[model samples]
Target: MPAEKKAYPLRISATVLEAMQRWSDDELRSVNAQIEYVLREALRKSGRLKAGMAKPMVDDKPDT
Candidate 1:
């Protein structure tokens, strides 16, 4: 079975949102996924991604 999706609320700058939308479009990912990717990368860079924690899988399809 496929994994269920979860919703998160976040606040970002207008420029950041615009950049994310572009990035997500280029990468064939949703805006939310792009944001999550950036957040996870930041967390990992700061040594916050635990070995035992599951990684996220973003769907290629955008929100309906």
Candidate 2:
């Protein structure tokens, strides 16, 4: 099953919001998507996300 998402309120300065908006536009992603992507990357870099976590296989053939 796909993971569920939770919504939370955020408070930030207009300067930060504007910067994020510009970055999100450049990345071709919604502001929320960019935020999530950035947070996930930060977590991974900080070792908060396990490196050995499961990853899907690339093969497309049906199981025999």
Best candidate (score: TM-score): 2
lDDT per residue (tens digit) for residues 1-64 in model 1: 5557778678889998999999999877888877877777788778888743436664566556
* Displacement of the residue 49 alpha carbon in candidate 2, Å: 1.3
lDDT of 2 by residue, 1-64 (tens): 6455678999989998899889987877667776776777777789887765322222222355
Judged by whole-model lDDT over C-alpha atoms, candidate 1 comes out at 0.76
What TM-score does candidate 2 reach?
A: 0.75
Candidate 1's C-alpha runs over 4 A off are: 1-6, 52-54, 61-64
Q: Candidates' TM-scores? A: 0.69, 0.75
Question: lDDT at 25 for candidate 2?
Answer: 79
Measured by C-alpha RMSD in angstroms, how accurate is candidate 1? 4.3
How much is 49 displaced in model 1, in angstroms? 1.5
